[model samples]
Target: MASVQRRLSALLFGVALAGTTLAGTASAHVRYVVDDPADVGSIVSFVASTLAVPAHAAIVGGSALATATGLLAFRRVRPFQRDRDVFADAMADYRDLLPWLLRLAIGIPLVGAGFSGYYFTPLLESDARLLFIGLGFLLLFGLATRLVAAVGLLLYLAGVAVDAVLLLQFEYVGGFLALVLVGSGRPSADDVLERVASDDDSTYARVDPVHALATRFRERVAPAEPYAPVAIRLSLAGAFVYLGLVEKLLNPGYALAVVAKYDLTAIVPVAPELWVVGAALAEIAVGVVLAVGLYTRAAAGLSLVLFTLTLFGLPDDPVLAHLSLFGLASALVITGAGPFSVDELLRTRSASPEDPDA
Candidate 1:
């Protein structure tokens, strides 16, 4: 039953991916915006003149037929349930084919549609950065599974969010989600079960903490390990602080004017200079807290609020700088410094009173 369900699920997912790709391709080509604007008379004329509808129809029809064939293949494999063992064996057989079908359905259309869209859409040329970003995301999804590439996915999604806000082009978010789903859906339940069944008993032997600690201390930390969430958070915080300072330095008069315009005195109902001082101090304090991973969540939250306000209040400038700061703020809020954090150290100490560090 599980095997049948898995096969059915694979077929459905493949069909869905194909349908989405076809729709995206059709939308890309059969639009008024694709044609030469100077020669265009009316919207309808532009669309009709540019779109190769017959070609699109032929491609989509072929894809639909292929999807139907995949479904039929799945149905043909459904009746081999002689026993539990036979069912398991049949599922194993299906798994081999199903992943390949999914790869085909998802990959071929994305590449084809991406190329068609890139060539046909004038907007993509105007905003080449976004096009490159989208292509990078698709390539990343193809190269690595989402679980192993979670950090990369997170970064890409962050970039997408910032781009969406700046350009008001929200479709990229949907594309990002689709890529994530495709990359993350690879390892099924049967794969996990097989891995567990194949585990060696000796590998589960108890560890000596003293020896473990000695080994850890003696060995140099691996470079890849620094790419973990906590390290990323600290690095991101430092970058944000540096960028913000650079912005302040470049436009010192403007920065001071912004501080004055907000009327910190009236808002705080206290000494005006003190209020300005407090805000400045708070910015520095939050950066320090984030750097040391102390009160990380609170620090990140504060930083987010500060950056959001800056994004709205600052003078209209290049979109990239604003978006980059916003992305960093969002990342800090979402990740909140992982294991290599002062907050974690405190939590560990509190949880275990017997520890020497505690």
Candidate 2:
């Protein structure tokens, strides 16, 4: 297990280094062209001219390397190893692909869009807008969960609806908020187990010191369980649902308009439509897989890849989003789907006779 982790870490570090190099280049070129009337256009041109090539190439190379290394690692590690080791290996496998993904998807576009939208629009500076957007999402997320508990089922739907509308207006910030709202609150596995033990006096007294110590060690060293997977899936679902609706209504040609305005056709050589469709499809697929608890580890792996790619493509400013997504993806990759997931349900049902797996 240690060996597998080391190999995975090495691969991920290489990918990250590549992504950072690309991101650095993108950042250097993405200066604010104040002469252009359309701020968005200038930003896009900068991205297309400076950032896109190296970032895209890095992604292609990283993907191949990750795949090859992963195959080699899988062959060496037996499947039915220690449960903790199995979980760790699975997580490492998922995380190894993330750096490249972030470089491609969220990070690159976000830098272009965020700088244009935040700096050129109203009174908000780019950094301030980013903070406000994050804060709004946090507040919305907290409010939505609170509403679900306070107002009951119908109200929960209404709350989600309201939140969705707000998110549509905001885009990435909205998505982030929806994720926070859906996934913000959850006790750690240790907390849950501790609570259970405390409530059951017999269990608490019966837990030997040696057993307790071992369990603590395991908990510290082992990969996370499936809880975060469920949260991320829910968050993705909310974000996509909101984004799909907004894209249809507000700016049906928003992507194209941005592309044409920037003269990206000559610079980037990739159609805006293609990029839009690809990104949308990726997000929708990620949301569906996560929500249904199907191929959760793979879904997480894909998400990590997507985010890592974004990190590379975007400018260096508003570094928080890049860092947050990176950390979140890493966590999901390590933890997988938690105890409440369909994966867990299936495992339980297969092991027992009474319960039907969902």
Candidate 3:
């Protein structure tokens, strides 16, 4: 079941990506001038906007399809009986899971920040963008976290200065810095490196009482192995749920206005009211899946698509608003629902001693 679901997710995502790429490429050929045709600056501006336009548009359609597909998939695999039991067991094993969970919290944002900077042009300079992506990988993998964290800190500070609304980015940088100042903690590649280093011939004297006292102090002050990642995931879930309800259900005028304002009528041929209702339902459905941690990757992947599409309609001040959700969704893509999710429940059931798959 898991394998099949994975394949389905991959197939849907691939189709969306391929379709979007083709559409973007196709649209590029239809020339439209923004200013004097002979002006180099005007030509560049027109070219950039043309290339970007299709992608921004395609993301909405792709996300809507993906979200619908995920909901259908979840209906097929959602564990009806043992979800509560699984959650209980997950909590029981929390101590063992803490390090791994912490890694998700720390690593996902780094990766999200980096990937967004790289893939989304106009966000950063080309060279800096690649560097940002590399930084995410390094941080995600727990390789040279101290150095990566330091770099991330500098980059995020610069980003905040450029666009202060991205306070979340700065917040993440601070978390990374905390890890750098103290340590990457358990299950990190840093710990493995330290372990290997410890085995080398270089010997050190035993710690004195004074040094031990300082170590204790540091431990006391060091950030409580952060759980911000968990909060981010839940917050995303809540935000989307609220948006779905308020924007589409309770007061659809606003949604309709947004759709009309963005000239998104092309994405849906049916009446705007029906499309709005469907979109709202999709958001609510996706939010429920996220909240319950069912098929989280699929849900997050679809959310990523929706968030990407939303960029086109957003005003300048809020243009980057959805970007943070993009990061969270990306992080969830990497981390899934974590230990506290229905996906884990299904996995645990499948692997149970009573099950033949075990």
Better of 2 and 3 by TM-score: 3
TM-score, every prediction: 0.36, 0.39, 0.43
Arranged by lDDT with the best first, the candidates are 3, 2, 1
lDDT of 1 by residue, 147-218 (tens): 223443354346444442212222222223322333323344323433444454534223322334423422
* lDDT (tens digit, per residue) of candidate 3 on 255-300: 5556665556787674555555556656767666766677676677
Cα-based RMSD of the predictions, in order? 25.2, 15.4, 14.5
Best by TM-score: 3
Candidate models: Cα lDDT each: 0.37, 0.39, 0.48
Better of 2 and 3 by lDDT: 3
Model 3 misplacement above 4 A:
1-229, 313-317, 352-358
Pick the winner on TM-score between candidates 1 and 3. Answer: 3
Ranking by TM-score: 3, 2, 1
RMSD after Cα superposition, model 1? 25.2
